[model samples]
Target: MVDPMKQFWVTVAAVFVALLIFVALPVVFLTGAMVSAVTSPSASGPSGPVVIELDLRGGVTDQAPQNPFAMFSGSGLSVMGIVDVLDRAQDDDDVRALFVRLPEAGMSPAAADEIRQAISRFRRAGKPVIAHSQGMMQSGAVVSSYMVGAAADEFWLQGNAALQAAGLQTEEIFFARAFERYGVEPQFEQRYEFKNAVNPFLQSDYTAAHREATLGWMNSVYLSAVANAARDRDMDRTVLQQALEAGPAMGEAARERGLVDRLGQVEEAEQRALTRAGEGAETISFASYAARPDTRRHRGPVIAVIEAEGPIVTGTGGSASPFGDASTIYSDRTAEAIYDAIEDEDVKAIVFRVSSPGGSDVASEQILAAVRAAVAAGKPVVVSMGAYAASGGYWISSEASHIVAQPTTLTGSIGVFGGKFVLSEALARFGVDIRSLSVGGETANLFSPADEFSAADRAAFSGWMDQIYDGFIQRVSRGRELPIERVREIARGRVWTGTEALRLGLVDELGGFHEAVQRAKVLAEIDEDADVQLRRFPAQQGFWEQLGLAFGGGAEAARALITLGALANDPDVQAAVREVQTARARAEGSHVLADEPL
Candidate 1:
């Protein structure tokens, strides 16, 4: 029989202790873990001979988050990181060789070219580089993985792996017929015939001009691939082209056909690499090697590498979701980064890396304005085109002091198109109605989905498109220093491969990031052989700030944070989210180029 008051106080204390153990303790543990990861020290240099192991299965991006916690967050490797590692290895005496594990799916052609160029440079430093592939499939243009492997001194494929070098192809889906069945109509117009971005919503099949433009770029990319593979394997171009047409070769057939150097498993490839690296050599993860601190110090002018990737949009670029899922180029964010570089006295020049199919006209203009401002500041601006840089992508790129692109880079779609879909009939089919009232302007209802464009609307819209298209051509003519007539000849919304673009005076050179960097160095009046530090933008946030953004405060933020966190951890969910975002973007009138294969 205990006293009542004492018993009540004891029970309250027990409940409080239980809450701390069950709830607060776990949160504290996680927060501490995050802190520890962020504050961890960088790895030191290797003491013995090392063969750097690069696993490309995770794919590569132009810029990866610099947050140390990014490793725990499952972010993939970056192209610049890999290039930096290779560059470091070239000068590191303890770095004996390089061993790469190629992925089943192919990378983007431009990305592969950049990595391949780095590998070529590594080999030129007298270090042997070997590539191992379990299987290579015809995913996303198919020639990418092989192109990267061709740069290696030795290439090995597993006995069960098949070589699917099926070449490049693209498909377009039309929804005009579907829209008709659903009682919806798409009203759109473009500046010219070659601007086929709107064709998916206007026609059921490819128009003549659309077919010509598509085939022109496709043929250029295909021939480049065939020629590259042939040159790498020391085989006849015609024979290699014929073999690719008859591909899907497996095991010994791949080696016999000169597609691979040897037939073996990954272990065998590792043994070969180890043998070449000599006794006492160990295989080290490339990530860990890259993280090692550089004891050597150099005081040199900084060359900033600012990346503009994904669909361009207004405002600061970030996933709206609470979890830091993916990134895109935002006009304000990019312009701010450019302004930062321009203001930095240490930054001598800038290399703007663009990987986009293009988006909003206003957003593109905003970024173009930043480029112009950078030039006016007396800092040299060089554009490095990656993957699909066309239309709005070219819009922002035109004013650069120089432009560099991979031979297979799809670019040069200088065009504009816009319109609204009338969905009133579709809603009526579902017994729903939309009513609108407007005041003050004749074309005030231009974006209203309930009404189709009137004759006046069409005329006014056409005039607007003509103005944008003319402005686009003038910019290109002025930037590229081509005659207005010559620019017009290639301007009509036509797409060109980097090779063709170089010939048409659209791009300054056909090369990868290394070449672009060399050009930047020369433009800055720095010696090509001089060592310069590369500063990236936008600047990385601190640990606590990143955590705050990742795990939001308040009840609503918590719910979204939890949901997004779950989605980010699930690959299937992430993929679904991407598909949904792409569909939504298209529905929202994002103008992506037709040549983007992904």
Candidate 2:
């Protein structure tokens, strides 16, 4: 008879091998499938003249994730992807024309401008682009939507749809009164008056400085939008502005007023585009065409495009919201990307795309340091400002070799504010007791929610804000080569449009991503007309790599490991395993345990 202990050990070994195979096979198969899915092209080019169809109802993003799975899953169309695909389509012989539908309301002003620029280039290449609008509803940035439609070679509006692209309007809500009624105190300090981000908490209405700054930027944006649309439609700016200012009009009235070229259903507009494309023409979704692999390889100097989109934060990973997913500029990751570009011999320049409303001061500083390092390493760093690059956003871009902004991009707001909402009084009324215990000095509890800032705390916080503001001014002065006093005049926590910012010597160029790339080319001594390979830095992680990261460590992994260890050590588990093993061995006519019945 075989030694029972030896047989038991062999049985356990066999079960362990079987368990490994059970778990490992599926993982291997799944990984292979994922790899194949990600590597394979989403669409292959068809043999015909294709009218690229783009539907903007899903809205546009600044950039899409580099992951192929995400790209093909309708993650959403991105502005840069559209621009790049259009640029390619210009040279594509089979691409006869573009048929695009504008979003119902609007997209980001800067994003719309970029798409318009791309369309303009495609049109210059002797291709027709037709844009259709269901309606220019009165919603977010209606004028921007009209600007895009106006850029197309042919603009179409749905019959019976209203042209509500009147102008831009803003509504502000102040929480001071509400907080006062609720017995909650909002204690805050700002470097100066124009920094009105905290004004909602401090005042019942817009202060003189706040109103002045708000209107200044708003007027500039309004004029720029009208001017752009007027130019696109080949109409007199004054006449178009007057007509739009008169009021909303029906589709026919809009056509008569020269805002749109035709009034028809979307289908009719699409048929017109196809008819214009000549016989045997076909239509392809814009996403499908964009997913086609590019056969052309650029053998020029590499320009690393680093995206720092969303609020500047001091850690890894992005944040999610009900509105949508917003990619945060994690300091460590962003800085690492900059450093990688600086060290890469093939990369001659860096185009840092900044789209943020600002966040942590330390995080912004970390990214700024990397930018400076890139410049010092002889790599030209050019900043391409996105929708809104305010406060910390501007901070990181302050020292770039060149700064480019869209005409309506919001920049500046070079100020700092800090404070908290004290809920002690409000909670007390609700019979909710909140106590604070700290061992440090008076200002140690500066951010304690239960206590409002004392006079000393306020003084201390104000001084800190002043220091941050001064640093911001100094950096701007040094970067822009402006006098400190001049920087001071433009600072004061005031936000400025790219147009006004350009006028005040704040931004280097008023343009979009394409222009920023051209500036980078010029600075890197590369031929301005030559195409350069744009390598995106902080390259997207592979699926398996990401998977490993998810399960590798942290609190979850620790808990899982502990639970697994405990399960393995439990006596009941061991006994159950032994019984199962003995039964399986007996069925196979092999001994497992001596005490088991034979």
Candidate 3:
């Protein structure tokens, strides 16, 4: 028989040892890893002859994350940042060549165009740019892939990969018939016929105006893609179009058609690039090269770059989710950034970078006021559009001294729409009763989803919409220096490509972010060749603070609450959930720029 006291002591010792092994060891290991990561050298550039590797798989963003923690957690590369890297490499003697890995799912047409332009410049320096692709498919990806590939001095494709450039199309879902079957009524109104954002809920099919506008932009985009591709690939426009129509070509078929330069795997392509770069050549990632600190010290005037990305919402913008998806721009946060730039003595000008399809009208107006305030403070404001800047996007941009956009950019959806649906009938089917008591005047029940708009309510809503529409036209007229009549002619919720917008006087120039920066320099009276430090707005949080915020339980809990609230109130989600209710609004509806599909 064993002694009870001895056995108890031995058991206690064993448990203590297990705890040290299971808990303490992991804690120590994690601490050591964190320390090493923090202390690691920040130099990302290679020392000798390097072939810069550009990966186009993830698609580009307009701005890099400002927070260091977010960046460390693998943030997507910004288009401007990649362009800057290429510019630097063009002058870098150590960089012998450029290698590109094409994406399977294509990037945005505007983004691909910018990258193509950068590559063209790089090639002008007598350096080879080689692109290798696995495959390109799906809607919109084919054109994007071809555009980028055409910029390369040598384009290669995997033997099994297919070139599926089938052209462009737009799709919209209509819910009117379904709503009627469920006894839900959709009531909506818009300033004009061209503002068909609400038509999906009000009509079973495209109205004549809707079809006309959609076809207009779709054709414009397709033609532009073909022209650019033909010019880059040195192929006849007609021949290229026919090949695209008869696509899904593979291997030698693609090579024979001059669509690709060679058929091979990625390794074979890399070997070719290395051969052109000469002996002792190695590859370095574009991301790593971009992360290196600038060797030149910039003491010149500062040009602040404030990015207003995503839908414009009312409060302070939410932080990026843990998954790294971007969040919407909040009016308060954007206004704060504008004010910060204006108040800074070092910042001589502001470049407002906008990439949005538009959102809350009130939120847009608030941001516009901030822009006016910045100008009032004697700061020259310039707007640089990426992919989109329409409706509320244009609303905030109209007052800028100058606006720049890519030819492929979509802009100018100047319109307003509003209305709600009557969901009482739909609910009655489920035996749900909803009742409301109102003590205010006639318009108090105007927004109630259970009731349809009365004549008085309709008149009031129409008059309100007219007032907003009139203000929109006046702003555009004054800003663009065009007559009110001309502004009205193009303002009825019509969408336009950036090229068309420039011709119509809706935009000041056709170009990208670099052009905007150059314009800002001229406005600030700085020389074209002079060095100007580009500063980002809404300054990033400190390293320690970000570290805590990223890992702390507090932030996670708060994010959960905010997400729940967003799910309840998000306009997109609300529109989807209560389709009938959204259709019945008298004249109050979310006005979105129609370029999202493109």
**Which number leads on TM-score?**
2
Q: Which run of 10 residues does model 3 get worst, by summed lDDT?
A: 28-37
Candidate 1 per-residue lDDT over residues 1-598, each given as its tens digit: 8566764554455344333433332232233333222222423334699899999888777667533246556436877678778988988989999999998887777777778878988999999999999988876666778877877889999998898887876799998899999998999888789999999999899999999999998788878877876787788999877776786999988888788899898988988998898888888878668767665324577998898877788986333543443556789989899999999998999999998888887899999999999999988999989886899899999999999999988898998888889999999999999977899789988889989898888999989999999999999998999998998899889889999999999999988778888899999999998888888877665443344343323233334333443434354643454455556557899864431112
Please give each candidate's TM-score: 0.83, 0.84, 0.83
Task: List where candidate 1 sits over 4 angstroms from the true fold.
Answer: 1-47, 65-75, 294-297, 322-324, 549-598
Number of backbone clashes in candidate 1: 0
| Highest lDDT model number | 2
Clashing pairs in 2: none
Ranking by TM-score: 2, 1, 3
Pick out the ten consecutive residues of candidate 1 with the lowest summed lDDT.
33-42
Cα lDDT of model 3 by residue, 503-577, tens digit = 998898988887898999999898999988888887755443343243332343334433433443344643443
For candidate 2, the C-alpha RMSD (Å) to the true structure equals 11.3
Q: Could you give candidate 2's per-residue lDDT for residues 261-280 as a string of tens digits?
A: 99899999999899988899
User: Which residue ranges in model 3 land beyond 4 Å of their true spot?
Assistant: 1-39, 42-46, 65-75, 318-324, 542-544, 547-598
